[model samples]
Structure formats: structure tokens, C-alpha cells
Target chain A: MNNEHAEVMEMHMPTEKIVGQTDLYSIKSSTVRTPDAMPRPIRVKAREVNVFYGSKQALFDVSIDVPERAVTAFIGPSGCGKSTFLRCFNRMNDTIEGSKVTGRIELDGADIYDGSIDVVELRARIGMVFQKPNPFPKSIYENVAYGPRIHGLASAKGDLDRIVETSLQKAGLWNEVKDRLHEPGTGLSGGQQQRLCIARAIAVSPEVILMDEPCSALDPIATAKVEELIDELRENYTIVIVTHSMQQAARVSQRTAMFHLGYLVEEGPTDKMFTNPEEKRTQDYITGRFG
Target chain B: MNSLIVATLLLILIGFAYQVGWSRSRQVAPAGGRLHSRPNYHGARVAIWALVPALLILGLWAFFSDAASRAFVMAQLPSDVRAMGGSELAQALSRIEQIATGFGVVGEPAPYESAAGQALREFRNLAFALVVAAAAGTGALGLYLARRRIAPRLRARDEVERVVRYLLIACSVVAILTTIGIVASLLTEALRFFTFVSPIDFFFGTVWNPRFSTVGAGTGEYGLLPLLWGTVMIASIAMLVSLPIGLMTAVYLTQYARPNIRNAVKPVVEVLAGIPTIVYGFFALVTVGPFLAGIGDLVGLDIRATSALTAGIVMGIMIIPFISSLSDDIIRQVPRAMRDGSLGLGATQSETIRRVILPAALPGIVGAFLLAVSRAIGETMIVVLAAGNSPYLRLNPGEPVSTVTVTIVNQLTGDTDFASPQSLVAFALGLTLFLMTLILNVVALFIVRRYREQYE
Candidate 1:
């Protein structure tokens, strides 16, 4: 029912004015596509998106589509607005003062910026995992139960316990922490803490999960663990991950979006993006020529 | 006068030692040998050595000179004049010394006393000259030894650093020793007071009526319960006003207020701390008291002009800045990641603060509250002038009450008889107040440490 309303809203979306453009000579137009590759139905459509912090622009008119139930990776050098663009999906950028977002971004065909949409509900639907493991200073059980409790998802104590157990199992942390459910979440190791945060986010059963450099602070073993969890999660949830490691992007994502100097240079299937990118900048980034 | 000359001489010797040491180190460095320390350090080490021993001698001589002079003068006095008791002899000696210093005495001194006074002047002069000469000679010896010891192998820098370390340790010990001294003196006097009144009576008696009797009469009711109740009452009221307002102000400054507003307002709030509590005392006495009484009159309640409510409100206003500033720092110290995590979990700002930030900053806020309580308990001027010093046991905030601090002030201010229990009670009250605040601070520290362990 809400999907039809969102579809009509996206069709009636007003055109946004493009700000300062980057001087990349080999930048591809927004309509450019790979040959013999069919387009997937869009779950999130960002059209003519421009973001600014105070007077300085952080993201140019960069448009892309995030397909449902697939892992989409945003890869960029530092301060290239990849994280900024990811924050826009859940309106997390609204928390930053003097940050202005003027664009049309639709989630499940609904305009997320519409006045009728509540931010709390929007954030619950689109959860995020940060670079550093930031579990609440609470018991492991309470950490997983936080979201479900806030959203009133559980009708009773047994239902809440089951939800917590299931969320932890989905995050691959249940077995290690099952006996110590009452211990503080912070008492866990770094990798375990990060997995606990994932469980915390998925506890709400969000449709989309945003991972902002989720594995950047993890070791190789931990990164591998989170990557495997991400792959497993792709069967149920639409995932958007921002990564500094191109190899991890290729390993975990089905689609890869490249951002450079505040511009979305090229985006396509991970196989094509790593093998033969459409833009020179994307190719240079993949080949380690220059950030 | 002789001491001043000796000090000047010691300073000059130190300066000369520094120059000589610097030249010697420079001379050594230019030779085939490497200098072990900088020329400045070599100079400083020599200067310290030269000044310290001489200063020690001077300090010891200054401490004992008067007693030694009097002893010498007394020994030369006639046996009949020295036959008097210790106190009487000391009094006669002071009178004689005053006459010798050209301050006129009440009556003519006896022939023996006049002779002793002349002897005293001569002995004092001799003693002063000996002390100055010895101190100067020691400084000269130290200077020569330090200069001779300065060589390529001399660890001047290391020696100087060691001296500095000792100096810093000595300075820190000074504070600890002073606290020990204060506690010791209070303990002794309180023990003396307990001899006059039983500890059980003082602690358990409900009535607080100190009769102001003579030293041995021991005819006063020194009950602590009423004063303790009053202190707790006022402190509770102060906390009731300060905790919520201070915490909210801190939250606003940290989470909600703009940078410009925070910058403008934080110092203004802190300025309340700088205002003399006496001024707040006047405000409570003149303004708040009358205002409350006026309101009470309108409501047909009997509220005195100088009631506990008035003093507590003013004290609470005084402590708001303390709570606000400390809690602000503690709340601000909470990692931004904590807030981000809560916000990302779809919590509103208030919800995040209530559920996460406040819980994280709880121990620190509790510490701040305890600090405010201690301040409220120890506050003298505000309670002295504002709390009407009624000394009556009452639970009503509308009535005037007396706190321990106000009673201590009342006992010690004027016409005090130190030997009597009335004046002596002040020390006992001080000791009790100190112990109470100490326990409060310890509890606060314990909570704060436990809280810190959770986050860090």
C-alpha cells in the first residue's frame, strides 16, 4: 500500500539544481550503462543529489540506484563524500548542524524526505553500523533487546528473549555470548563487539542496513567474519557498505559505486567494476594508480 | 637587621658561585674533555649548594635566638629576681626588654632588672653577629666546594634534577603536613571538649543549649542532633533546587545550546561562583526572606523573614554554577560515540540523554551533588546571616533553623573564652563536619571510579 504512494511521489519529484561539478574529464553521464547487462529493479533511487556542509559542498549531483536484497558497496578515498552519501539514505546527515541535503532520495519508492515521514521510523527501517564497535554500556542481552523494546516488537518477555537470541544468532555472536548474556556488551572483544552492534541493528528487522566502514577498524580475521556475516545477511536485507578496501568490496558486494572528489564517477556490478570499470578514475582507483 | 645582612650576603655569594661555575664548565668543555652538563646547569647546581646550607643555619638561628637571649639574660640576673615562678619571670623579662627597646614601661624597673636588660641587649647583639658570621662562612665553604667539584666527570645536571625532585616532593609534603596539623589540633581540642561533656550526651542529646558557663562548671546541653537535622534539612533543600536546574543547564549547554550561546552563558553561570556568599546572604536576608514571608502571609502561613527555606534557596542559587560546571565537564567527557550509537538507534535527543548520557554520567553527577552538599553544609556566611540561628529543633522549612556552621560562628565570633566549653565546642563541631564531608567525598570518589571503569 505504501509502495504505490512512494512510486507516485517519485514520479512527481521536482528536479534539483546541480552544484559545482568536478573537473574529471572521463566522468560518465548518469545514464551510462554496461552492455548486455539488464537493469535490476531499484529499491533506493537517488536523483541529482547535492550535499553541502555550511558553504562547502561535500557531494555533487551524484545519482545511483541501490537494488533490494543485494549488497551495494560505496568505495572512495578519504573525504570523498562516500560516507556523506551513505548517511543521506537514513537522513543521518540531519544530525550534523549546517549540513544541507537538496535532492530526491526514495526508499522503496517512497520519498524519505517527505514531511509525513518520521525520522525515528525512518532510522528504524534503515539501520546503520559504524566503523568502530560502539555497543551500548549495557548487558549483552539488553543491547540486542534495545531496539525491539523501543519499537514494541515483543509482546512479552519470552518473545523478547527469543528475538534477542535470534538476532544474536543471525549476527553470528549467539554461541560465543550465550552464556554471558548478562555481561556488559563492552566486555566483549572488538570483533565480538562489532558483531553485537550488527545484532543490535538487525534486532529491529530493518529492510536496509547501512555499514559505514564497518570493517575498517577490524583485523583480517574479524573482517573475514563480518564479511561472511554480510554475505549471509544479503539473502534477507538490502545492504549498503562503505569500504576503503577495494578487495573487500569485490568480495562482499554485488554492486560497487565509486565516489571521487564529491562525484559518483561510475557504478555497476562488482565483477565489472573491479575487472573493467566504465570510467578512467574508477579504473585508476581499482588499479591503485592514485586515490 | 643582622639576619637581613646575612641573607643579602648569601644571595651575592650564590650569584658569584653561579658565574664561577659557568666559567669553569666552559673552560673544561673547551679542553680535550667533554662537558657532562650545560654551563647553566653547572652554575645552578653550585648556586643551590651555596644557598641551601646557609639558609638552613639562618632559619635555625632565627628560631632559637630570642629564647637563648632571654636565658642568658636570666642567668645573669640576681637569684632573688629569678626566684619567681616561670610565668612571672617571663612577664618581668618582657617588660625589661620593652624598656631596653625604648618603649616606656608602666613603672620603674628594679635595679636587677635594669642590669639584666643591659645584659640582654649585649647578649642579643653577640648572638646575632655569631649567627650571621657562621651562616656566611658556611655559604662560602659550600660555594668553594661546589666550584672545586665541577669537572668533566661531574654529573651536575643529574644532581640538579635530583635536588629539584626533592624540592617538589618537599612542596607537596607541605600541603599534606598542613592538613595533618589542622586535623591534629582539631582532634586535641575536641578531645578536651569531650572531657567536659560526655560523647554519648553530645551525640545523642536532642536539646542544644550551651549554657556559656565557666571552664569547670560544665553546665551546658551540647546536643548535635538538632544542628545535624538543620544542616541536613538545608542541604537537602539546596540540592532539591540545584540538582535538577544544574543538570538541565549542563544538558542544554552540552547538547542543545549553540556554540555562541554556550560560550556566552557558561562563564556567566560560573560568575555566580565568584560572587561573595555574604552578598547572597544579604540577598536571602533582605530579598528572598521577605518575599517568602509575603507569600506566606498571603497564604496564612507563618514564614519568618530568616527561614531555612530562604537561606537554602539562596545557597542553592549559589551552588548552581558548581553543579552546572562540573556536570557539564563530566557529561561532555562522555564519548561522542555513545551519543551517536543511541541516536542511530532511533532515540530522540531527550531519549538518548535520559537513557544513555545521563546513565553514563550518573556517577559524576552524583559526585557533583555530594560536592554541592558539602559546600552547603560548610557554608558559613550565608547560613550565619540568613539561617536565623534559632537553634530550635524543627522539621519545617518555613521556620528559622541553625546549622553547625552558624553555631560555630556564633560560639567563636566575639567575647570568646577559649578555656570554656562554649568556645571549645567549635572545634568539636568542626571535627564532626570534617568527618561528615570526608565520608561524603569518599563515597563520591568510589562511585565515580566505578562509573569510570564501566566506560573506560
Candidate 2:
């Protein structure tokens, strides 16, 4: 059933690439560029994104398209600017002092960096989960309800309650926390706390959820649970995850982009990228020759 | 002889002992075998043993030398001098001791006194010689024993660590004992005051007219109510002025201010703390007092130049850094992750601070406020200069009212006998203030601990 749907998605997506176009896939590396490869519709598109922190350029001109209802994992070593690019989608970099981002990022064809864009509304549309579990120092229920309450997405107490419950249910945390929802979110285990943070992001019902190495702080069992949750969530949400683990990129992502030294090295179907990467650096990174 | 000379000689002796022990430990250890502890541990152990025994003997010698010399001088006095009253005999002895020390006698001494002065000089020399002999002997014995005990398996490090632990415990015990001594002295003096004035009348009486009663005919009212009320009122005003401004300053420094601005502004605000309270007192008495009176006249309200309002406001300014710095540290400690979590959820910075950061930092902020209040309550110079020291029971802050600290200062500094009710009342008030500060600090510590546990 999923194979048939994927075939239909591939047919609907654009198939041809102009030889000299500036689209994400058309920018050829010396080794390879997989144009017209992604099967799903692009939910977010970044063009020539360059980021600087206090005069030091941390990211070169890099761009990628995040597809809808699919996981696009950015894999790289530490300080490789994968996380930096992910933050540009929701304008999270705006919160960092001395950090400057120059380029265009579009969510549903609307320029996110335009002066008319309200950052608060933009963040509501594109949520983020951190590398570490960062549930607020509030009750479990309140942690889940925080987003909906802040954006006034729920008008009534009952609506907020339902939102919290549905968000927790979607994050696979409702059963474990339902009886003790009033307990402090910090009192939970690390894995449970990360799930609570995930539930918090989902409560807003964002169009895209950005996960920055979400399972990096978790044990293997917890990582498996989060990966499973990610697989289930891709049915409804466009997920863009940045991960240091190549295995995690393989297990959870449908399309994978490898970054090196602040540049997007290569991007293609996850299976093809792992099995037959055209870029030497991408193969080197995935095969653990060197990060 | 100078005490510094003795202390220097003792240190030199300990250094020599360390060298001897270090060499001996190296000799005893097999060339190829590993020693249980480093040579320095052995050296330190020997030095500590030598220094401690010598210090004990020196302390004992110093404690008894004066009494030994005085007793010798007293024995040398004639029977007639011995028959004198106790104070007169003491005076004679003091004069003889003064003559011995060549500090010059207050009056002409009799023949017997002159002879006693000579005998006092002899006794002092004998005491000094005996002290030196005993200290040297004890130090030598300690050095010899420690050097002999230095072996490859001596466990010198453990021994030294044990001594270090005891020394640390002794230092803490000294602090605790000093606090206990202070509280005990206060309790005794307060008990004496209560003997003169009943506790019920003192605690519950609204009047605070402590008349100067020398003959104990009728001790005046020593009511604590008015002073307590004044302290509460001034502290409330100080809190009212400080709490919002200080908390806002902390929030701005922690969350809103840029790094360079925060770095620049934080210390500048903390400069308010470094400005001595006396300076604040001067500002209150000379500047704020008159300014308040001018505003009062403009509004047709009678405000004293030196009133609770002026004092409270100035004190609030004085403690602004105390509250702001502590609250800034606490708010900063609320984990960047917590703030990011809220901000990631689309909450604006202020909303995140108000709902997440402040709530997480609430216990710590409460602790900081309590600490500030305790500081405000115990403050003396500002209140002394500006509160006007009027022991009135009125609730009007514009009226001159005295706090506990100010009243204690007023009662203690006046020319009255220490045994009198007025002077003894200072100790009673001091004890009350100390207990209040103690309780507040305890509660603050508890809250801060709980707050730490929450995030950590």
C-alpha cells in the first residue's frame, strides 16, 4: 500500500532538471548531483543560505529542499552547519545574538525572512526539538499544553486539554504520563522527557517539525522508540532531522543530505546515498573513514 | 621578647623538622620499592607534629606567666598591704607590675612595693626561661618521634589527611563556638534586663519611654512593640521599592540585555552595593530627606526631612545590587535549555521569562528577597542617620520612626552604665534581631536548596 502511494508521489513530483538551474538538486558537486530524485512535494526550500557568527562564516552558500510528509535527515560531523541550516527554517537563529543569516528560506512558497513575516507566527508554524530533552520546568500536562496555550490555538480549557492529550498521544507519551500528568516534567527520565518535548512541539500542530539530533542524548532503547515515533509521525508531518549518527540517518530518513565544512556535500534518496554515494566525502563520512 | 620573634623561631624549627623527616623517609624506603606516601606527606606530618606540640606549650606558658609573676609580687608584699581591700591590693600589684615593666608607676611606691617590683622582675624572667625550655623540649621530642616513625609503609598521607580533617573541623567549630558565645552573652544580659523589667510589659506594652533610672525606684516602660512595628514598616517600604525594580533589573540583565550591555551594567549596578551604607546614609540625610520634604510640602503633607520614607528609599537603593545580583545569578542559573524550550514553542522572550524562567527561578528569587530583607532589617548606618530615631508607635511612614537596629544603637551609645536597663535593652533587641536574621537565612537556604534540586 505504501509502495503504491510512493509511486504516485514520485510521478507527481517534478522529473526534469534544467542543466543550469539554481534549484537545490541542480547545484552539481564535482562528484555527483542527484537532480529530480526526491519523490515528495517540497514543503520548505532554502536558496544560497550563508550563516555568519560575529564575522566568522560558519555556513557557506548551501541549500536543500525539505519534502512534505517525509523525513529528510541532515547528517554531518559536529560544527558542519547542518544544525545551523535547520535553524534557518524557523528563524531560530534570530534568537542567537551576533549570529547573521543571509539568504532566502521559504515555507509553502512564503519567504520566511521577509520583513513582514512575524517570527512568533513563523516559529509556531515550524517547531523545533532540541538535542537534549528540554521540557519546561512545569507539569507534564502543562509541558504538552505550553505551545497551544501560548499561541491561543485552544480557546477553551476543554480544548486545551484535548490538545494536550492528542499531542501526547501522537508523541506516544499519553499512556505513560496520563495518570501523573500533573507531575513535574523534569521529574521524568531522559527518554520520557524528550518525548514530552516532542509532545510539546506537536501540540502546536506545526507544518514542519525540526529535530536537532533529538536522540543523541538517549540510550539505544530510547533511540529506537524515538525513531519508531519519527517513522509514524512522517505520515502526517514534514520532519527535518539533523543527526550525527549515519545509522540513524539511514534508519529514520527517506532522503539524506550530507554536509561537510559548512557546505551541503550531497543529497539523494537515503538508500542510494548510503549504498552508492557519488561524493567521496559522503562515502568517507558514512563508512567512518573520517568525519 | 617579641611574640613575632618566637613565632618565627617556631616556624624555623618546624621547617628543620620537615627536612629531617623527608631525608629519613627517603633513607628508610628501599631504593627499588615504592613508598606508600610521597616524601612531602612525611615531611608535612613531622612539621605538624613539631609545630602543634610547641604551640601548645607556648600557649600554656603565655596563659600562666602573668599570673605567676603577679602571685610572686603579691607574696613579696608586706602583711599590711595584704590586709588591704581586694581592689586596693590589685591596684598595688598593678603598680608594682608597671614598675617592673618600666611603663612608669602612677604614684610613688613604698619600700615594700619597690622590693616587690624587683621580685616581680625576677619571677617574670624565671617564667620566660621555663616557658622557653619547655617549648624547646616538647618540639625536640616531637621532631625526634616523627623522624623515627618515618618508614616506607608509614601511611603518612593518611595521617596527614586525618590531621587536616581535624584542623578543618576545629576551624568550623571555632566559628560555631563564637556564634554560641555571642548568643549566650546576649541571653545573660537580656535575662538581667528582664529581672528589672517584666517580659510581658516589655513585649506587649505600646509605650517605649525608657527613663534613666539609677536607683531602681521605678524602671520605665521598655515596650518592644513600637520598635518591632517600625522595623516592619520600614522593611516593607524597602521591599516595596526594591522588589520590582531589582527583579526587573535582574530579568533585563539575564534575558533581555545583550552580552556586552549585561557585562557593563551588572557591575555598575553592583557598585550600589560597594558604596558604603554610610554614604547612602549621607545621601539620605542630606539629599533624599530634603527632596522628600519638598515633595511633601508641594502635596501639603507633613513629611520630616529625616523620616522612614527617606531612610527606606535610600536603604532600598543601597540593597538594590544585593537583590539584583543574586536574582540575576539565580535567573541565569535557570538552565538555558528551559528558556530555549519555551522560546522554541513560539513564546516570546518576555512570555518565556514570565511563565517559564520566573516560575523555575521563583524559589531562588524568594530566597534572594528574604536575604535582602534580612540585610535591610539589620542595616544600621542608613537608618541611624535618616530614620530620626523617634520611638513612636505611629503607622505613618512620613513620621520619624526608629527601627530595632537604630534603637539598639541609640540605647548603647549613650553615656549610661552597662548594668542599667537602658543599656542592657540593647542586648535584648540585638538578640531579637539576630534571631530574626537567623530564621530568614535558614529559610532562604532551604528554598535555594530546593530550587537547585528542581533543575539539577
Taking the candidates in order, what DockQ does each have? Answer: 0.50, 0.61
TM-score of candidate 1 versus the correct structure, residues matched by position: 0.91
Q: Interface-residue RMSD per candidate?
A: 1.0, 0.8
The local lDDT score (0 to 100) that residue B255 gets in candidate 1 is 97
**Positional deviation of residue B97's Cα in model 2 after best superposition, in angstroms:** 0.9
Residue-by-residue lDDT tens digits, candidate 2, B110-168: 88888888888877777777777788789989999988888899999999999999999
What are the per-residue Cα lDDT tens digits for candidate 1 across B217-248?
65689999999988988898898998999999
Question: Which structure among the candidates has the greatest DockQ?
Answer: 2
The value of fnat for model 2 is 0.73
Q: How do the predictions measure up, each by TM-score? A: 0.91, 0.93
Candidate 1 lDDT, A1-291, residue by residue in tens: 146434533553434522222222123222122322455577899998999999999998989999988889999889989999999999989888789998899998889988999999988999999989998888999989988888899999999999999999999999999999999998998999999999999999999999999998889899989998998898799999999987788778889999876888789988778666766566666766556
